[model samples]
Target chain A: MTTVGEVSRPSRVADPDEAISAEELQLAARNHGIPLEALRYDVTPAGLHYLLIHYDIPDVDPATHTLTVDGAVARPLALDLAALRERPRVTHRVTLECAGNGRALLHPRPVSQPWLVEAVGNAEWTGTPLAPLLREAGVAPEAVDVVFTGADHGVERGVEQDYQRALPVADALREEVLLAYEMNGAPLLPQHGAPLRLIVPGWYGMAHVKWLRGITVSTEEFTGYQNAVAYRLRRDADDPGEPVTRIEPRALVRPPGFPDFMSRTRMLRPGPCTVDGRAWSGHAPVMSVEVTTDGGANWAPAMLDAAGGDWSWRRWRFEWSPEPGRYVLGARATDASGRTQPVEQPWNRGGFANNLVQRVEVVVVAE
Target chain B: MTTVGEVSRPSRVADPDEAISAEELQLAARNHGIPLEALRYDVTPAGLHYLLIHYDIPDVDPATHTLTVDGAVARPLALDLAALRERPRVTHRVTLECAGNGRALLHPRPVSQPWLVEAVGNAEWTGTPLAPLLREAGVAPEAVDVVFTGADHGVERGVEQDYQRALPVADALREEVLLAYEMNGAPLLPQHGAPLRLIVPGWYGMAHVKWLRGITVSTEEFTGYQNAVAYRLRRDADDPGEPVTRIEPRALVRPPGFPDFMSRTRMLRPGPCTVDGRAWSGHAPVMSVEVTTDGGANWAPAMLDAAGGDWSWRRWRFEWSPEPGRYVLGARATDASGRTQPVEQPWNRGGFANNLVQRVEVVVVAE
Candidate 1:
């Protein structure tokens, strides 16, 4: 274990003018986001879903692997894969977005995973509700926070430990929260935390820990490295930032037509075209979605589909008759809570919770 | 369709000192490579498999999709997914690698997919042999090349067409060549060319067209864009270089210890450790593998496991005892065809067929 003061490489914002460093490129190559065109599918295919692995995927043998629940519980329990499957199963269609989805777009980019609005996916996860399991274990009255630990181990900012995070007792016992063992009707893929993982609905991906192995109920706040040093909305190095929770309002426009091999600029023959995308928010239901043809100078309301699920994204479409010229397309969403996607990015030291409007460049050509 | 003369964007090499451009970063985010740490598995899991899609994954409905085999064949046949699955089925453990696996590492890097040596995966493909299907269709005596076309359509360098590639008639009829519909005991995932795809063993990934929709046997040499223009080993724009075919010999060491969050420099305690990795070659079986503790200054032979399959990667392991220090670990493989991984990157205009030695940096700390 590394002390907080024995830092080797401290976090720092990257120079806006500099190109992506080799280290960022290395992370980008390992982790991937869904192609914008994949928005056509309601439930993202397993392989096309966005993925971010903090460390390595742990080698797990499912037959012998067991998850233990203890600490401040009247009855400690060790559950195997078969035991978890035998319980009442409930499936939910949920949308998960990384807290740092627009990190790279920040003027002074954060040096972690350099995501750009594509680090979000909607999936159908099947598992038993976590509330029932906690009830079966008979949680003690003094429990304030429940910490979930995963098998993936690594050194992040000089701290060597298994990945862990804690949720308040109220959030941990929500009916929608699950100990997910399956994804899209199939057993979890290795990269997706095979055997078991934690799924906290209406929260950023950081709250849903993968490769989950142990759960501990504590009386006090669990201030681990992840909860204390990472995933916080810090304004500067010295400021003790607030913990980042829940997904922010976001809308992404699928790039129209075909993409150029090198530049990825979209091209299409000028004519009647239907532009569509997906939008979601964790704080409240999305009320409206808007589209922009000439960047942000003008905006038009788009038709939103019926609510799919409380935690899932809603489809929005706009009809347009385009001309032969270059255009920058954009999309923004407003939730029932009055939270709206920002036209300009809200810069932070950790680049957390950035929901900047998406802008896609397209070229409409003469037929 | 775009004409050859109406060029929109021409190909060029990137400045050596320039950081990765936004365009390259966009492509990197869309397509992902397997993490080096995933080398521990003999057969890569579906989600962890390296993927490189040239264009959008076409919306494929398995029930309605039909594969047409036409052109110079004596009898034309349009087979649906059910008919193809009913034919004689065989499975092979084969390794597939992208031609531009080490593209980003080239001095003047190619501006396409900025891959950094992780664009390879070995999977078990279940499908019927293409030879029996061609024999049933009755191939024309004068047929010279077989062109396979995929539903993924996009523009590359000015030419717009479905992603297509051609193989010589002799190579197309090889017993190992398959019209695959399954990967790793499961039905193909959407991004992996659901319904059907071609599997050409011992060839670079470009030769194995995905989302396969049509097969046309022609009498003349097929000069398609993917074959004639892309995937070529050109030195300059004017040079009509040789076609890149087989996967070059290469070895990658599974990165040891834990990684730092931003820099990815690994750290571990000083002790004895066993370093292992996977190695393969499309032209021939890997005969020997060597490891170096001090960059490439010295090399020692590693123990190679018995061949797993004719076309699959073989495992190699090396045991080392080290004191506290910094080390640049390296691995290189030599194939039966006398092709060995080059210490220096062999530069090319397309950045194809680069099998440079793998280097990993690690720092040993006192316990």
Candidate 2:
């Protein structure tokens, strides 16, 4: 995997595996369960995506590693990275998102990871529960928030840069988050958030801090660049215009977009056909997903899997035999919060907050 | 720096100062400029904290490296790493929190990165904004969330993993979250989330995925494992009776509990002695913090800096000239939501959400 020093603008490597056939590259993306559209590009190709690290990548040899928690605590706790690993390990397949995953769409597009379409992906993370660590830390009652900082740095406001964010002490002690040292069944690649990345499943990617370094207990707020200026949302240029800081309940279209543009004439059987896809939301299990045959005009409720946690996508399918003609297939999702997909795309300068319904074009043929 | 594989159950590294000094580490955590806490065991040490990566870290070797954005849009965007470096750069500091920063604190703590307090950190991130990437991506009206996936992997539910998450299309395009390849005036390290880590300031840590592999333009949410489960607050705990799957807004206590053999006698002082400390909240900025000098008798308001974003921590200070003796110093914080710190701590099976008024005993030398 690549490291911070190794990462470059998309154009450099262009294609990491150009040696492989295009068809194979596409297949690889698919085999990796990536959206087919993601593989369409070649040189740092359009729509192709990658991930980012928010901190300095530290170099730790497995032999000498320790985790300690002290200060404002009952017992100054110390645990080696090995000891942490020795604890019972619990694993889960969750997603780590970049708060600006879709920021490129925003107008005056911010100067950052020039992500197009493939900025995000799914992974199974494994680690011990953080709760035990806090227990080991012997959290003091007065602690307000546990501030976590990373080893990465950059100048912010002309000052030496180091990033940090705080989680409520109560929340910090939760068991869901992990001091993850592995990703997708492998040791974290330096380029993909190597050892000790915070895996916060339900919130936006910002919540999943990478290049993790220090955790301090404090009774105040920690303000840094990424924590203050980025990943904010506005409510349609509406009244009061307050940014939504917390991860709003939202769902995603799985097998996102059109899948390699299935030839309408080829897959066309003048009989009832099944339109299938996946749906998922942050935090809550997906409640229901609606399918729109003709845009939003006619809506048919799609069958969905039993509600799953906000951690995974829910596969949904709708059976529909299209008449011999060209038509647009759209899907709208709704979570437990009743927040459904919007028909009209939100117009933002940066183009963030894109929760538009999924529209796919399909044609039917009569032999 | 430490890699995920390098992080053992218990870390072994000694305090900072070797690579990153402990005082500087403490400054990184305590400095109001970017209030961050040193998490981990101090092992994994401040300099060796784990790093997740995104967009391979691009030092460019200065002689090589290029970036380009092209896709199903109106414009084909391209830039070499040099061009990106040359492009106007905007710098800002904010907190990048892991959505699951407090996951370990959740009840029935879900299985994942069992990060205690070490999952989060603060840094002064500097890099080009992502807005240009969006412009390059040619975001369309149909686009929804911008998805991000990293190169890291682990097994969850018996499946190989890749870290993934999504940002609102708008946020993803913002220039604040940068394609940061540098850290504190240096190229990114392999473990420090090198190359380009999304600086989704103000959001949780998960949003800033590391070891970036790809970015995708989508009309729906990016529901990947790391993005899905890592960051979440269980707004619904159902009365300590039923098991909860989510985390709640919480706080951590430092110097947890009081020191043995010390009583109020050690706290009383003669004149003009200041009792100072800090306070913070997750997902909520500290609005006002209060100090109780008389064991809850008389409350004095602590000075607070202007509230920035919700992801960062607020620093507070209070001055009190003690009457010549030992006295207990108590401090509490309140957020914009009118949520104030509790006098007594809240109890949970996981020992999370332990935010309570902090009491510190200080001895004052009478003049």
Candidate 3:
């Protein structure tokens, strides 16, 4: 029931850097079509975006917290959280995307909450490598899978939403696989998954669990839904069939540089106006963004920010003109591999990969 | 600490049946070493044994009590409890055993409230065949699992316990698989898994889910703990080296015709008195139950019951002269397959398969 104007502009916007009040940010997130009440959303700023982890948060108290690393290993260990914190730590800026991001566009559109292209976010995370811990646990190279269990529980869609999905051992021991305890230089906020979380970079957000509790190193693949069901994508161009296990790198194409539409009010003549937007891809860095004002016939390149994180979305802006009438603005984003956003997205039972070129409508006034 | 007499004989017990008063039964059960308080026994009758289902009771309004059968079938159908009740009904006498019953017997004896062997009971159940519903649903012969989900949530050992377990389609569609609407030949009791429950005869209590909600037919096996972890048992003879799935049936043995010690007091003669005990096994019936007055050396065969459930224990008895002396009475139950209870149960990280020859100490009276 909220109008576009009401969404794009809120009465108050919280400054992300300023111990920003959550109350205002909540309203702003709502205005911008984001759900801040879903889980631990400690630092989910209004404009910066967010990620939705499919797993329930694990409850761990300081007194009873211990991480066990065993299975196909030379040694087994039970390390407490405090002991784990003593290990060398690393920090990295990365983006996590829920496989179901933009999934609302799929046909027969799944029976879950409809997402509106915002279940993706970038953050600087700090944690220790799970690889070293596995090494310490004496995990054999022959290990096949790593299972993560959280403290959260509930029944979702007739499924026992107990422990989350398990990842392949190869994925588990990745150097980038962090047993993260902090986000954006701050202790994890409860809503965004506090205490500890697992970060699997370059994969859908569902893989990175929030409020992580138990880590079981195993010798086989754990194919439960979050990994096997939720993060799935179409297999190939030929088969519009059922989705496969893996997800490919894809980007989102938004409107040109966060331009203000009100600026066009003073312009009497049909002249050039700056159009602004954002672009982000899960697998690779954004290479370029293109704009198509005359539908899909002709395309023009837009300027993009060069200093953005590889996982972070790139802001893009383009120059466009109106002829005293209605104008439809279109934008497409390309990744490093030359993979470009499609004009129309494929449909699936669960909406995923809905990266169709985005269009914004506007009206120009006559002088 | 409260005295044994005071703690054991609280005058508060709820009874659904008028056969025995609450006060008298509370004193009796306590005298027999049962902890009536820890059970959270809301309604405790002296004659009828207490029944405890693992999951929370589902609250079903008669107006919306419909059971829906869908997927991989000839017809997807929904039947209300009224319709199910009106259908041809059948009744069967069965005993339900919790997977963790006698769990305290495990070595290293996992840290749980030690059980005094009172977690087993038998009841008559009434309901319509689930097989007919499956047949109407057109269940494929190839269907491997029938998963039952319930509406109960509990926090056990810190894990959310919304219960779900899958049974082989062959096992699920059996003639005895009842969508039970009644327990003990009476209208279904709320606390005893009412509304509807799955009664899988011979399987552990985990297989009989309470608060039945939905059943899903699948061609794959469910790997949740209730299926994959809990209820699992290893044969004492099976090499400790192999990892297998099926659980061997076991049984409990109790002293026969107890409280008879006072009946023989009229003789006014005391030397060395002994009492006989009973034994039961889950698989292969009760081949033999031996009683030992001197630890477990001297053995004597105790009488066995004429009729026994496939997975039920047999009552046994032995006698000795009543003298002023203290003795440890031990009873070991052996299944037909030569599997005997060990002096101390095997050790497992997960407290499971705790079947040990029961040991109880008693003091003989002197005249």
- By DockQ, the best candidate is 1
Stretches of model 3 off by over 4 angstroms after superposition: A1-48, A51-64, A234-272, A294-297, A365-367, B1-367
> Please, what is the TM-score per model?
0.97, 0.41, 0.41
Query: Comparing chain B with the reference, what is the TM-score for each candidate?
Result: 0.97, 0.61, 0.72
DockQ-wise, the better of 1 and 3 is 1
lDDT of 2 by residue, A172-224 (tens): 77778788877656566554445566777666666676666666777665455
DockQ of each: 0.54, 0.01, 0.01
What digit string (tens of lDDT, one per residue) describes model 3 on residues B1-367? 1112211121111222222221221112111221211112212222123333332234456568767776566677788888888888988666555545454444443322223354545567789988888887898667788888776543232233467788878878778778998875566655555588888876656678777777888777777545654444433323232222223344343332111111100111245444543344444566777777566677777665554445333445456664545445677777777877776566554345555555554434342
CAPRI classification of candidate 1: medium
Weakest lDDT window of 10 consecutive positions for candidate 3 chain B: B257-266
Best model per TM-score = 1
**Count of clashes, each model:** 0, 307, 39
Model 1 regions more than 4 Å off: A1-8, B1-8
Q: Report per-prediction Cα RMSD to one decimal.
A: 2.1, 25.2, 28.6
- After TM-score superposition, the amount by which residue A288's alpha carbon in candidate 1 deviates from its true location, in angstroms, is 1.3
Cα lDDT, model 2, residue A16: 25
